[model samples]
Target: MNGVLAKYSLNTVCNEAGCPNKGECFTRGTATFLIMGKNCTRNCRFCKVAKAAPEELNPEEPLNIARAVREMNLRHTVITSVTRDDLPDGGAGHFASTIFEIRHLCPDVTIEVLIPDFQGDYVALKAVVDANPDIINHNVETVPGLYNAVRPMAVFERSLELLARVKERNGNLFTKSGFMVGLGEKEEDVIALLTALRNVGCDIITIGQYLQPSREHYEVVEYIHPGQFKKYEEIAQTMGFQYIASGPLVRSSYYAEDGFNYLKRANATAGGDV
Candidate 1:
């Protein structure tokens, strides 16, 4: 998987973000493709992706990613990217093109894009929404109280609004958002965040432990237990999320295909799509 992604000059969040599940996912013949560029404009403290001047957009990237997906024979392909605030449309066109190319090359595959906030630009967000991927995910990496330390440049309200706007633009779309626990957030704080997500009509939610990328990054205040994750999942499900994935190793795109399929089956059983 590493060699193939390198051959196509592609990146994956699983690698760039230092995801804990990358080794397992790679061994299973799956990966979350990263597009736009390697460097991110926003230097979120919890992130491991390079924080520097971003590279110029690669016009051939969409086709390269499509070919890689076809070669990998991925039934469900996940695409994410660095926060390219330097770009006018925040790399939305690149995301759209990649979706289009992947759809053309692998018509049977399901596409999931875990996108940046586009700095709260509705037009930019709409560009990707208009592309019509199977699931659109934008993670609010930490709670509001921890945002200043963990994600200083990101706005929690804006992230919620981004999810809200996605639903408004296309009600049929399965909008999703996620946040990390163990960042000094109380149980009430987690519940509040879930309420905000539910109010915005987010269909899916993910909760994970906040593992510090390095000593230079924000410290992980605690390592949330597995049982706590289960409790959070129960709370989210009770609050009406169609699906929830919560655990210590869970990331926004972790086990994403399974979550989507679970929602599909649940909807089918419930007599209609949520």
Candidate 2:
């Protein structure tokens, strides 16, 4: 995986965000492709990706990602990127290009894109929607209360609106959002967050513990147990989430293929679009 990614000069959130499952996923020949550039414009308190003035856009990145996907022989691929406020389109066009290249190179593979808020630019978001990926994910990252402390540059309501807009623009597209636990949020806060996501037509959710990336980053308020994760999973399931990935090490794209398959089955069973 390292050789392939290096050969293509591709980036991945699993490495940039310091995901715990990086080694395991890489060993299995899977990765969430990170596009646009490695430097993020926003300095989110909880994120580990470097914050700096990003370099010029790599025009060939889209094809490189497609080549890597084809070589990896992935049946399902998750693509994410750093927040590119520097770009006029917030890098939405680049995302579309990558999606189009993947479709052209590997027609049968399922593609999931975990995108940024595009700074609430609907036109930019629409560009990504027009590409028509199988799933569109925009993670809220944490409960509303933690926005100021953990995600100071982001708007909680705007994130929810982004997910809502994806469904409104294309009802057939599956929308997903995720948030972290152990951020000093109460149980009621978690329930409210889940309800809010569902209210906006979100179909899939991922809940995981917030492990501090470094001493300089946001401190871990607590270490949520497995039982608590299971409890949240049960609650989300009852709230009509087609699929939920809840565990200590479950990142937004973790076990994404399984979640995608489960959603397909659920939609088929309910006589909805697959």
Candidate 3:
């Protein structure tokens, strides 16, 4: 998997973020492609990606990601990027280009993009929405109360708006978002977060435990038990979420294909487009 990504000069969030499931995902022949550049402009305390003046956007990155997707033969590809606030469009055009290129190469592959907030630029967000990927994911990351401490640069409401806007633009697209527990959040906070997501018409939700990346990063407040995770899933299901992935290791793209397939089956049964 490493060889294939390197061959195309590609990067994956699995490697960049030191995801625990990388080995398993790679063995299963899947990965979440990271594009634009590895260095992020934002210094979110919870993230492991480096913070620096990002390098120039590679003109060939879109095609390269497409080639890598084809070579990997992924049934569902999740593409995410480090926050690129420096760019005028926050790399939304690049995202569209990458989506377009991937469709050109692997027409059958499902595309899910875990995008940044685009700094609340609707025009930039529109660029990605126009590309029309199967799913558009913009994680809230944590409860609203923890935003300043856990995600200093990200606004909780802005993230919610982003997800809502995606559905408003195209209601058929599967809108996904994720947040982490173990961030000093109370049970009510989690419930509120879930409620907000559902209110915005988010069809899918992922809840995962927060693991401190380094000593300098945000500390894990508590280790949530599996039962609690299951409870959260049940709560989301009752709230009308089409699918939920809740567990310790359930990152945004974890079991991504499973969620995509589940939504597809449910949509087909409901006589709705997927």
Candidate 4:
């Protein structure tokens, strides 16, 4: 996995965050493409992307991603990137342009976009949605109490509202959100987070353990076990999430194609359009 990603010069949340699932995903011949630029404007304690001036937006990124999709022959794909707040459009237009290019090249593939909140700008969010991705995902990352320490630039309720807005605009689109669980969040707080997502119309939830990428990053308060993640899945099911993937190594885009598989199956069982 290490050797494979180096040559591609690709950006991935997995690599950027030191994701534990990297080896497994690479073996599966699946990869998440990070577009725009790697340098993020926001300095979150949990993220490892370098904080600096924005880099040049590669005009050929979409074409390169389309080429990778073809070479990987991926049946499903996840495309995500850093928070490019420096861009006037919040890089939403670039995100959509990549999606549409892939759609033209890979018509049968299921695509998922794990996106930023775009600073809660409705028009910025709408640009991505208008492209009609298979799933639109924006991670809540953590509960409200830890916002100042964990996600200073992002608002807790606003994150929920972003997912909610996706459903409000299109009921058929599957909405997903994820957050790390062990950064001082209580059991009650976890349940509350699940409830909030359901209340806001989120259909898929991913809960995973948080691992610090470097010594300077946010320390792991607790190493949650796989059992606890399973328990969270049980709770999420009760709270009405159609798809819940919770595990120590599960990422928001971790095995996301499987999530879409379950999504299609569930939709079919209910005689709903997929």
- Every candidate's lDDT: 0.91, 0.94, 0.93, 0.86
The weakest ten consecutive residues by lDDT in model 3 span 66-75
TM-score of the candidate numbered 4? 0.95
TM, every model: 0.97, 0.98, 0.99, 0.95
In model 2, what is the error at residue 52, expressed in angstroms?
Answer: 0.8
Instruction: Please identify model 3 stretches exceeding 4 Å from their true place.
Output: none
Deviation of model 2 at 93, angstroms: 0.2
State the lDDT of candidate 2 residue by residue for 67-125, as single tens digits.
99999999999999999998999999999999999999999999999999999999999
In candidate 2, clashing pairs total 0
Model 1, residue 112: C-alpha shift (Å): 0.6
* Best-performing candidate as measured by lDDT: 2
Per-residue alpha-carbon lDDT of candidate 3 for residues 31-97, written as tens digits (9 for 90 to 100): 9999988999987888899888898999999999989888888889999999999999999999999
Model 4 backbone overlap count: 0
Name model 2 segments beyond 4 Å from true. Answer: none
Tens-digit lDDT track for model 1 on 1-274?
9889989999888888889999999999999998988899997888899998889889999999999999999989999999988889999999999999999999999999999999889999999999999899989877788888888899999998999999999998898889999889999999998998999999999999989888998888888889989999999989999889998998888888898889788888989864
Clashing pairs in 2: none
Question: What lDDT score goes with residue 171 in model 1?
Answer: 91
Estimate, for each residue in 1-274, the C-alpha lDDT of model 4 and write its tens digit. Answer: 4454455566777676677787888888987888877788888899877878888898878766776787778999899988899888889999999899889998888889989988888898889888999999999899889989987988887888789888877778899999998899999999988898999889999998888888898889999988888899999998889999998878898889999999899889999899
lDDT of 2: 0.94
Candidate 1, number of clashes: 0
Assess candidate 4 and give its lDDT. 0.86
> Which of the predicted structures, 2 or 4, would earn the higher lDDT when compared with the native?
2
lDDT, model 3, position 61 = 93
